[model samples]
Target: MLRWLKERLAQQNEAVATAVAAADLVDKRYAAGLATYLQVLSTQNATLVEKRQLVDLQSRALSLQANLSRALGGGYRPEMTMTANAHSTVADKS
Candidate 1:
């Protein structure tokens, strides 16, 4: 799942870069009078929206990684789960 999230984040980052480049092209075209100002503004707005979405995805990915780390006890160890179970069983007896 962590690997999947990392891959997804990478894809989103690429999308953000593509949107930024597209917006830059729109700006250049508008300056040359080949595209309307409204068109440029629309492309820029799309870029902003994509950037915001990318940020959200990044945040979720980080959160998921953190949760996974916590779940695995920072890093999985062969004896960690058994140790935890033993501790819980001992505590319940009291």
Candidate 2:
């Protein structure tokens, strides 16, 4: 289940990136008068929705990971998870 959630999160991240790019394009088009303000607003809304989904998936994945670690009888420390999460976030930003 954790692996599946990770996979879904990765896909959702891609979806969010695509939605953001689309929103940016729509904004530019609207500025040039080639697209309606409504179009720009719609794209921006879609991007926000995608971003929300990504955040949800990330939250679920972290919860599941923590539960798994706890179930494993202290084999994994909470601090270790925090460190790993920080590294992953940095890697993702890059």
The predictions' CA RMSDs to the true structure, in order, are: 7.5, 10.7
Error of 2 at 56 (Å): 0.3
lDDT tens digits, residue span 1-94, model 2? 4578878988999999999999999988998999999899899999999999999988887788778778977568656879989999999999
Model 1 steric clash pairs: none
Best by lDDT: 2
**lDDT agreement with native, every candidate:** 0.85, 0.88
Residue pairs with backbone atoms closer than 3 Å in model 2 (clashes):
none
- What's model 1's TM-score? 0.69
Candidate 2 achieves a global lDDT of: 0.88
Instruction: Give one digit per residue, the lDDT tens place, for model 1 in 1-94.
Output: 4677779878888988999999999889988989998999899899999899888988897777678779876885445769988999999999
lDDT of 1 at 82: 97
Q: Evaluate model 1: give its lDDT.
A: 0.85
| Strongest candidate by TM-score | 2
**How big is the positional error of residue 51 in model 1, measured in Å on the Cα after superposition?**
0.8
